[model samples]
Target: MSEFLNVNEIKEKVSLLNLLNKLGFAAQKVSGSEHFFLSMLREEYTASLCVNDKLGVWYDHGAAGVSGIKSGSIIDFGLAYWYPASFPEVLKKIVEYAGVPLEKSHDIPAVYAERKTALKSSTYQINSISETITNPAINAYLNMRGIGSVAAGHLYELHYSILDSKNKSRNYFASGWPNENGGWEVRNKYFKGCLGHKGMSFLQGAANRLAVFEGFYDFMSWKVENPKDPASTLILNSLSFLQSAKARAKQFASIEIYFDHDRAGMLGSEEFAADVAGSVDCAFKYEGFKDYNEKLTAGLSASKKSLDKPMIFSAENGFGR
Candidate 1:
């Protein structure tokens, strides 16, 4: 007979923070008891997923589970993270990744309480925004994603500081771009977040046509490939802005979507197509890859490997000859 698993027991044993770290996600920002992270559940440029370590709960401001619940316990996170996996499987994976033995009693450490009290009041402040991208680290990050050349005009160098209640401050830098509301969608290799109000990034072009992408990097990748295509562009920044993008997309005669090939992206593309009359689902152009950036990087890698090799996107697939 198999050992029966108690959901409550598992929740108590696992550390959500540790589990997230193990899953390759670290808190990009923290305020009081809330820790913010780039939503692993979806492609988002901002940290919409906020986890309250003290309460041992998390919520994705960008999206909700199939049940429409946006916030829940670690068990809920496990269920959503390993969607379609059996309950037992999710529990097992959570335990394995969290590295918590079932038989042991896991207690919340004193450090958490101390840190919470120390950072009870904190604020993230934007120190400066540069019109040019000059940081070697940010440039390298952009280059690694195959967008260094094109990212210059589209992104900015942002210097920001996080100050806790104790008056201690830590300054950081990232490459960023602005959304419609003047908020900065910032990104470094290790972090993804927004500096102010969260919204979409739009670039004006021809009135009749528009191209939509899930994130800025995907838009940059598309720009790298089609430098002269004059379609007006919108980077949804986060799929949370899908409805808003759809509303704006209706103004154009044609719309092209370049969302990821994942489930959320597929559904979002379908939703956009159904809602907007002339929208085209261009994700098929990079079908086997996660997103346009990934496909672009793969092609870049392949080119470095063999110059004569054909690029990943060819004329027949609607990527333009």
Candidate 2:
């Protein structure tokens, strides 16, 4: 098999529920087409993770306040379930669990054939794109991330549909931005995925300096803090595009990297700094937080708390300054 993996093909061919079963996780309860199970991610007395068998999606009700994703497609679940695993590794595991062959084969298994037939019609179609974002949910999500004010020119309101196995289309909306390959990097509260070919987003600025970020939210967070920055920016959208981003950074005299503060982010930052001379890892600015956006949101929360505090007119410490 080639090193390249067709992610969409695997998603279409694999059965998420079947994979869960293979992993020794059975649904604690079943409600119509939805199956409820204890979160594979964390221990819980009640089942909070729900797998919608009909739509091939999962959502963990208890994960909203936790780090990582709360809801997404099967691929997203795989990545979250197998935390710290590379994308290729996750894909291989999914294929293995689903009993699907990595390479194309004429002698397909019966179970694999049934899954393919059931999911063949599952697809995401873009219905329309609006230059301005107006959806309340999208706006709330952006504001929650402390980027609503800066997201105006950088994002769009995307109206799309997901075609299910029964040939019924479910309409949804999200905030999206275009990538270099003319595809969209879309995100809402519950979903995050590319609408087409995944690639990095490059924003033109200074020719001598560049700032690289792992995702668009981090880029926007930096913009929120530094509105006057003149450096050219590259949002990798995914760490898998680090090699391409590094090659692009070589043209600039200086590069600033703001990856997450996790193990993978630290390794990526170190690798980029090693390959490209004059490159610096700027993740130290958000050292304790996961990423730039997390730091930004924390700052916003702190400011809100300060504003809400009651003032005392005592002489102690000059009336609390």
Candidate achieving the largest TM-score: 2
Residues 196-310 of candidate 2: C-alpha lDDT, one tens digit per residue: 4456899999999999998999999999999999999999887656666788899999999999888768877998999999899999899889999999999999999998888
What does candidate 1's lDDT look like per residue over 12-38, in tens digits?
768798898776566768999999887
Pairs in clash, predicted candidate 2: none
Clashing pairs in 1: none
After superposition, which runs of candidate 1 have C-alpha atoms over 4 Å from their true positions? 1-120, 164-167, 307-321
